[model samples]
Target chain A: MNIKVAFLAILLMALITYIPRVLPLAIFRKEIKSKYIKSFLQYVPYAVLGSLTFPDILYSTGALTTAVCGTVVALILAYFEKGLVIVALGAIITVYAAGFIL
Target chain B: MKKNFLYGLKRGIPIALGYIPVSFTFGLMAVTGGMPVWMAIFISMSNLTSAGQFAGTYLILHGAGLLEITMTTFVINIRYMLMSLSLTQKLSQDMTLPRRMLIAFGVTDETFTVASMEHGSLSFFYLLGLITGPFIGWSVGTALGAFICSSLPEALSNAMGIALYGMFIAIIIPPAKKSMPVIFIIVISVLVVCILRYIPLFSSISSGFRVIISTIIGAGLGALLFPFEARDNNIQEMRE
Candidate 1:
């Protein structure tokens, strides 16, 4: 792609991401009402992140097996209340070592 | 207060560290996919989104048309709209329009999680502090990754790609372990995604819409299953 064309695509991408974020806060200045809506919003983070992590993460590191190993390591470390960096590093190291063996 | 801003900055340290390896991998992949180093950096600098950028770049590499790229990005990132809508409940009443707009731009998954968990109304300065660190880390990591891709070993780079997903798992696991409702939501969402992936009837649904669809279903089910009780906390208060 031409540099100009690529730049335009990036600009459009930036707009889509930015608009979603800005629009909601801009239009909905008042507090949200309704118990159902609030509860739905509360669970959005977990549900969204969960769906994104699985299946996708399995293919992220180039192999299903290594990704599973890394995920297992991450879960174990996180279960122990490890910090984010520590848990992530633990998974990375696990996947890296697994790369050598498998 | 200065202390709150500093606290927010301190909290952002882990987020920035988490972003580096992920953004670094994006940079490496972009260059490998035939993008110029500067173009990859530009995309990171402008977008600051993981899934959206990844999907958009993949289409670009395939020579997808502009309309295709735009639609793909919109579908992939529509979750942020939901996240930002939730975050509006946390912003202080007196926050001005421009500040809300600026803060909204920084409402990535990590920042949203951190900001939402805070007790009181979120401050503009604190929000700025929180986003600035990760912003720099993400952009700089991309630049570094693009520059060093030739020298970095493929095995090591591939392994490092797991760091982002590891971070995602790390973020969700503790909370899910603590709350049965959260665990239910996560398990249901995963099952929905799996079914959508393998079932022939759902195979025609694109990946971007699949995420949006599953998220709505999972969150809707969670709301129905575990309704919120009235509470005095700011997070709850803001929504009321």
Candidate 2:
């Protein structure tokens, strides 16, 4: 990509990415009054996190067994209410160790 | 005000830590794929998105046209619309339009999840603080990877792949354990995404859209099945 073209492409990509993020917050200033909408908004975070983790985490380490091992470790640590850093590092360490064993 | 910002920065540390390896990989890929180091860094700085920027950069390297890039990024990032709208209900009443717009620029998946999971309404300074570390981590990590132009150890780098997801699990599991409804919502989302991913027919749906669709199904079902009482709708009072 030419330097100018690359810059332009980056700008366009940035603009497109920004639109979805800004538009909703910009337009919906008033608190949503509908109970269903409020409930949906409250649940959105958990749902988003759930979808983002599954299947994708299974492929994170590029090996099924190690990925599963790491995931199991993460789940256990998280179940115990470990902090984010601890859970993340526990999983990483699990994957790294599993890389050696299997 | 200063205290809130500092607390937010503290809360953001793990998120910033998780971003480094992923953004490092992105930097390595972009530079090795013939992009200039500055350009790769620029993309990280300007976009601050993981999958969208990665896809957009790949297309640029392959000489895809602007229209293709635009459509691809739009599809991938449309999930942010759902997240941003959700955030509207969480913002403190004092949040002004300019502050909201500024904060919106930093609304990636990780940031949105962390912010949404906070106990009460979000403040502008706190959010600004929350986004700062990850922003710096992302840009600096990219610069390092682009400049070094050498791969990290395979095991270490690959292990880091689970870091963000681990953070996600950490965030969701405790809440799910506490609330049966939360557990149900997560299960619904996981089931929807798994079907979309594993079933060949629906597999063609892009990852971005898969997240959006699954979120709607899960949260929508939650809304229908367990509507919030009027008092529960006030996030600040709920926190109290």
**Which candidate ranks first by lDDT, i.e. highest?**
2
What are the C-alpha RMSDs, in order, of all predicted structures?
Answer: 5.5, 6.8
Regions more than 4 Å wrong, model 1: A1-12, A61-63, B1-40, B48-100, B107-134, B145-150, B230-240
The alpha-carbon lDDT assigned to residue B48 of candidate 1 equals 88
**Candidate 1, residues B1-240: lDDT per residue as tens digits?**
688679889988888987887777678767766689998898988898876787677667657667767876775576666677777878876668988888877778778878888899888888888998888889998998788876767667678776656666766787777778788988888899889998999998766556667778888899898887763231321110
What RMSD does model 2 have? 6.8
Candidate 1, residue A88: how far the Cα is off, in Å:
3.6
Question: Model 2 over residues B137-226: C-alpha lDDT tens digits?
Answer: 889988987887555565476677777677678778877787787889999999999999889999777665676688889989998998
By summed lDDT, the worst window of 10 consecutive residues in model 2 chain A runs over A29-38
TM-score of each: 0.70, 0.62
Clash pairs of candidate 1? Answer: none
Candidate DockQ values, in order, are 0.51, 0.50
